[model samples]
Target: MQASQLSRVLVVGASAAGLTTVESLRRKGHTGPITVLGEEPHAPYDRPPLSKQVLSGAWEPERAALRTREALSGLDAEFVFGDPAVALDTAARTVRTRSGRDLAADVVVIATGVRARQLPGQDDQEGVHTLRTLDDALALRAGLLAAERLVVVGEGVLGSEIAATARTLGLDVTLAGPLAAPMALQVGPLVSGLLADLHTERGVRLRLGTGVAGLDSRDGRVTGVRLATGEALPADVVAVSIGAVPATQWLEGSGLTLDNGVVCDSRCRAADGIYAVGDVARWYHEGLGRLIRLENRTNATEQAAAVADAVLGDDRPYTPVPYFWTDQYDARLQVHGFLPADAEVDVVEGDPTARRFVARYRSEGRVTGVLGWNMPKQTRLRRQEIADAVAAAPAH
Candidate 1:
């Protein structure tokens, strides 16, 4: 594919992946008419900071932005703000906006991302919120400052981080989730036990294996959550962080493969002249031997580069090890590679009792993943080392 031939590119969603896609195309010397359609009025911002630093009041909302207005404007890319793509016409290769505007493109990149899943009957309540976008984080932070009791509905990274922040702000927080352990999804049962201990030590109430029945509202202001067992936990604010559902509802008739997210091949190609990347893309990982959708900036940045190369017909399969990091209170947890349920977990260094350490997960005598607490540099190096080792080994 010649650079001149790859013209008229239209990228939907101005999040990390979409911004990187446009910049990548230009960096590859493709001087096509690039247009970035963003649903948010602001330019691309760092999402991880929203739940961590911004909500903690250590960083402002403007500081969380990844791209400045000048930087985005200087890229020579058309910036369409305050308009979200409403529908997709795959047959015509056009996208319809919520304002009823139609945009044509030679190639379409779906980086619409995912929205934080909300509990039923929670959206309309005043004190009920889900943090995903900058607005959500700002509102949540404000509410947390005034609330005495904070109820978090999920035990994932976002939920844990928010609970940590709420606690730091002198608010009583309760983490309500179905998992028996806090970090069960990433670090297995043993590590989850360690994480739960940390939360309990911080005076956080852990309500494990509990399901929220609905939101208790007083004249549209959320006051508490009704548990499945008919018990009502008194709270000033309820945050629904159940998980995230891919924002692919607009692609229902788009004729692209979507299973939980936009299903793409290893090359990130959903169809001819169309590709999907980032958290919204579900692609097969050769190392893991399964289709997985990751919600990390590392995946978004790395996959964006791969998608760029694939669009240029390089045929480079994206096989980078999935990596992620989370900041909870004083501890920084970093994860590298994949953690399969069947893998054997081993403690590499440090003890969970001290609340800082590294752990390795292996499958069939091969190290498949690494979990590090307060070990950023080690996590970075180990991810590359694991990817190389996995590449050299025979197919399992």
Candidate 2:
């Protein structure tokens, strides 16, 4: 399809990526009809603050709003809120909604994102929670205030942030996860150890190296979790941040390759006149020479802009350096590049003992990534260096 030939563009989500796509299209001189379909009843809101500021009572839920009512109205887009795209026909270029409404468009952007993963029998309990939506944050915040002991059942970014915020609320918090150390996959062993020490020093108990076997409940509220180690941890509240899966079940039999996410080309194009972005898209990366799907907020916006460019006839490759950030207690950790859980890392600046440091991750003796623990300026300065190193290094 040609850029000028485009008429109506349908965005299947109302989250960051989808809204940014709508904004980008307008900014790029696309004078076309844009309709944003949202599955949630509430307006689009920032998600990162849900686990930290919103839970800690530092930021009200409304503070996470992405745009004001007037700002959204200025975009000149029709919003079909509280309805989801249940199916799509690529040949017909039509999307079927849950209410049996058929909407056809000249182009489609899939930014459905992901949903929180839950454990078996978790819904049988009441006090258990997950922090993904505004309602989830509100419920968890109330549970945090009323509970004496809280167990966060995933030591990843969400769980760690919630544990830290719970600690600030004076709740006896325990962090349980399968990882040997917290955030080992994100930063590195050195920084992970530093984070572990920070949590321990803040009076948050760590229960690492095992997953939850089962959850115990009484009177419809979760009491505690039974560990795989055959030990029971008591808790008055539980937040299961086990992770999330792409919300692509609606695309079943839609002829899209569905793996961890909707598979797309390097340009973020899934099919003719179709594009994917955000956590629901697993696009091939020209720089990394691999397929990557990132869940970070920055990645969502970057990919959305790239998709918008693609829609407007920019044939450039959509490759961006992966970046993510997490705030726990008073520390803000930022990372750029891919450092898997098993990636070998060596500190190149400062020391982890000082509560501030920078670590460079290397694969096959070449720097591939860098992480900053309160070293924002230094880390930002070294990004170019790492990109150069990655370009010069031999492909693995």
Candidate 3:
């Protein structure tokens, strides 16, 4: 079926990606019928703030709403909130919700995103939290407010950010992770070492280079984290940020290729009339010559636009420079393109001592990534270097 002839489009996730798909469709002149199915009752809201602003109490919950009520109503789409998609009939292009309603459409977009991963037996304990949804962040914030000591498991972006927020809230925060330093696997050794210093100076205890073995609890309340080496770090509260797995379990028998996420082509199309976007989509990258799924906020909206264009018969491949940012204390780090762990990094501008600089990452003498530490403009300008390099590289 052609784009103009499409009768209905069903989006199965009311996240930034899903909502953006709806908006992009309207903006691109796809005025046909559109339906949005959301598992959460709340309207689409921005998630990046849930960790830093919302959890820190710097921003009210309402401030995170992606669109005003009137704005959402203006989109002219049917929104089915609080009903989770339980299954998909790929052949019929129909989605079955948990409430036993089957909705069929000309095109179906999966933007269900992902669920936070927890350590074994962590969920049964009280005072243990995972921050993925708004509800999770609020609950964690409440726990942090009443707690004195917090042990954060995982040294990735989410865990590190939560540690910074909790420390700012006057909690004695201990960051535990298997990596050598905070964001070690992400920004490489040099930048992560600097982050280690920053967190240490900010009074966040670092318990790195050890994996969390399990949770220590008594009377159904979490007490601490047990390290792989058998050392126990006591805490009044614990937050798990190990990572997240794509929410694709419901697609188990749906006949779509599911490997870590909903596998899709370079166009983000999973089947003839179905597409996948956001964190739940592992789409092929023509430039990288492999499948990639980014969980960052930027990819959600960017991929949504790409999928929306595809739904409207745009044939261009979705090739984008991956970008993400993290705010810890006074430091705001913005990264563009790919920063492989083994990539050679050089400070191209500003001074690292002053904690304001733009660094370039090179792999095999090719500019693969650029990082900005409080140098947003310069870093953004440096993004073109990576883009130019990618354009010049031999197609894989």
Candidate 4:
């Protein structure tokens, strides 16, 4: 297949991955028709800042946009705003949108990202929120300003970041989760322990290894979390960041693999002329010899580019060294490769006690991952090492 062979391309989800696919296609000399359908009415924007600057009131919502009118104009693609795709017909090569419009296409790229998972028994409440979209950040920011006590459930990157930002804003925030330490799944126990210490030192209460028995509220407004241990922690605001569920429900009958996300081949092809990218795509990694899905901003862009190439008839396998970063309080953590909580750790540079260091994670004598805390320069330089380690990972 070539650019000429593709007459029209339909990209679902007008997000970073979807917009990047359109840009990549145009840059690769693709002159075919392209249509982008977004669920949100706002223009595509960067989501990383929603948990940090936006929540902290340091950056406006417009500043987080991925493209301005001028930038999007150069892509020469049809933009469909506020209309979400509702169904996919793999055999007929068509898509149905919520507006009752059936779109035909020569190729389709599904970039439907994930949505934040809410806790059970949680409903639309004044003080309860989940940070995923710009609207979420705006609402949470306002909620934070008015509330004196904040309870953040789930101590993952998003929860921890929100806690840090809330604490910086002078809110009494209690960070609670089932994990022994925050971000232990991403950087191992040693680094996670240091993060626990950092948050405790910054006046953010830590309530690890706890489950919410219920949410206390007044007149349908969440006020605090009631622990399963028969204790109540009072709060004025609540944020749940447990995890995300891929937005792949619309693909249910499309004959596509839906395990965690839209499972794709090495080339990111989900089916005969269809592809998937971003957080909703769970593609096979040749290096890892396993199926993996990443929810990071960096992986979204890289995978979109690879999906674009694959749609253009390039069958090169997409194999990237997994990377993610989080800035909590005064600590900045960057990681390359995969680091499970149980992996053995080896100090690479600096020291954890100093709150600034880099460490390599190993499994069965092979360097499987790397972690950097407040070591941005060193972290960027360690990518090659991660790639090398991935290439040398043992066969399944």
Top of the candidates by TM-score: 3
Candidate with best lDDT: 3
TM-score of 3: 0.99
Q: State the lDDT of candidate 2 residue by residue for 1-396, as single tens digits.
A: 667999999999999999999999999999999999999887788999998888889998889999999999999999998999999898777899999999899999999999999989988889999888889999999998888999999988888999999999999999999987787656667787888999999999999988789899898889899999998999999999999999999999899889999999999988999899999999988777788899999999999999999998999888687789999988989888778666777788888878688888877676778888899998888788667865765563
Candidate 4 residue runs with Cα over 4 Å from true position: 394-396
RMSD of each: 1.6, 1.3, 0.7, 1.1
The residue ranges of model 1 lying beyond 4 angstroms of the native Cα positions read 392-396
After TM-score superposition, the amount by which residue 29's alpha carbon in candidate 2 deviates from its true location, in angstroms, is 0.7
Q: What would the per-residue lDDT of candidate 3 be over residues 1-396, giving only the tens digit for each residue?
A: 568689899999999999999999999989899999999999999999999999999999999999999999999999999999999999999999999999999999999999999889987999999999999999999999999999999999999999999999999999999999999989999899999999999999999999889998999999999999999999999999999999999888999999999999999999999999999999998887889999899999999999999999889899899999999999999999999988999999999999999999999999999999999999999999988887788888
List clashing residue pairs in candidate 2. Answer: none
Per-residue CA lDDT of candidate 1, range 1-396, in tens?
545577788899999999999888878877778888999998899899888889889997889888887888778999898999999888677999999999998889989999888787776889988999999999999998888999988887788888888888899999988788786777788777877888898989988777778888899898887778787878998888878989999999889888999998878888777889898999877765668888899989989888888877787778888888887778888889878778898777777677667888888888888988886776666676578766877664
**Error at 190, model 4, angstroms:** 0.5
Query: Whole-model lDDT for model 1 versus the true structure?
Result: 0.85
Per-residue lDDT of 136 in model 3? 92
Residue-level error in angstroms, candidate 2, position 192: 1.0
Distance from true location, Cα of 195 in model 4, Å: 0.6
Question: Ranking by TM-score, best first?
Answer: 3, 4, 2, 1
In model 2, the runs with Cα more than 4 Å from the true position are 393-396
Instruction: Report the C-alpha lDDT of model 4 over 253-349, residue by residue, as the tens digit.
Output: 8888899999998898889889999999999998889999999999989999998899898879999988888988778888888887678888888
